[model samples]
Target: MNAAETPRRGHCSDFEAPVYRNRWRSLALALTGSLLALVPAAPTAGEIYRCARQDGGAPLYTDTRCDAQAQPVPSRTPPTIAANPAPDLAARHDQRLQREHERRQALDARWLAEHHRAAALDQRIRQAVVEGRVVAGMSAAQVRQAWGAPDQVIPQVGDGAPRERWVYRGDRDGTGTRSVQLEGNRVVGSGRRAPEAPSTPPRTTPPR
Candidate 1:
């Protein structure tokens, strides 16, 4: 063909637009790949055991076994937790807990040292009750704990102390009634008394 009759592609031509855009895209892709290759491959978001689902959502990942397809993907973020505690660290933690327990026990013993005497007295009082005996200075509650409830409770405004007399039923063989005297809720004395005999009614004849 003659030079004047030569066919040439125009800037606005539809085919040239597409070809030019494709060439630029190819150059841009090459540049991007070269830059990516030089940049140390970005640590790959770490390897994981991924279990993909049929629902097309994100896959499940775990440090343990995977139940589904486990193809490693770059999108997975590694778990933050370390697999397990160091053995020495765990042992030290256990020892620290034991030491804390011992320290607390010692503190309790020191703090409640005065109450130890009261506790021992309470134990002795309980032992007295178990032996079926009431002692002087025994509280009303302790006396009840030793013996059962009294059959009669009589309050007296006495000269010494506002005393209360608790009388118990006489023995079945008519031995005697047991009594306890209390001064302000504490036992002062206890004794037995002869049982009162039943009085008989006098016989009378009908009007004959």
Candidate 2:
């Protein structure tokens, strides 16, 4: 073989072929790895705030409320995931709705408790006032226990028999009024009347 051809064949060895191929492959892999590192990471959840009561003080997010003077801080821990992925969306929504339902139930229970207490106090106060007014020929004290106190009372005086008028009002968001009229100390007549709502006063123009 010619001298140049002989040298070329020696240089083109099996070891040389693999070394060149591996060098290019290594460079390609390193470039890909560098690009992946440059990519940004996913975002996370944010903060929340809470307070003891509105107008009580500035709000904050803590298991416990701060002092009246101290403003609330951003003290609550953020949720683990900012949004629900497809697989978890339904479960997350159900959890949120359950929490809402529980919150509503708690609020309703508190409202009902307060309403019951107020109603009991009002009944007691009315009974004291009515008991002092009972007289002969009038409905006995038993009536008072059965029915609430009179909203309107008309005193009576005359021969034959004296008379009294007792009016009972109902609660219907001011839409209706119910009255039970007691005459001569006994329940005589009862009726319901549509409430005459007060007309709204005309608004006056502000002085120029």
Best by TM-score: 1
**True lDDT of residue 21, candidate 2:** 91
Predicted candidate 1 versus true structure: per-residue lDDT over 1-208, tens digit per residue: 8976665654455556888889999999999999888764322345656676789999787554453334554564667976785579888999999999999999999879858977877788788899977777789999898878999999998786679999888654657888889998888898877867789999999997
Tell me model 2's lDDT, rounded to 2 decimals.
0.62
By lDDT, the best candidate is 1
CA RMSD of all predictions: 21.1, 32.0
Query: What's model 1's TM-score?
Result: 0.34
What TM-score would each prediction reach against the true structure? 0.34, 0.25
What lDDT does the true structure give each of the candidates? Answer: 0.79, 0.62
Segments in model 1 whose C-alpha atoms lie over 4 Å from true places: 1-121, 159-161, 172-174, 194-208
Model 2 lDDT tens row, 26-135: 99999999999886533224423355567787645654334434433445565786665458788989999999999999999999999998788667646644664322
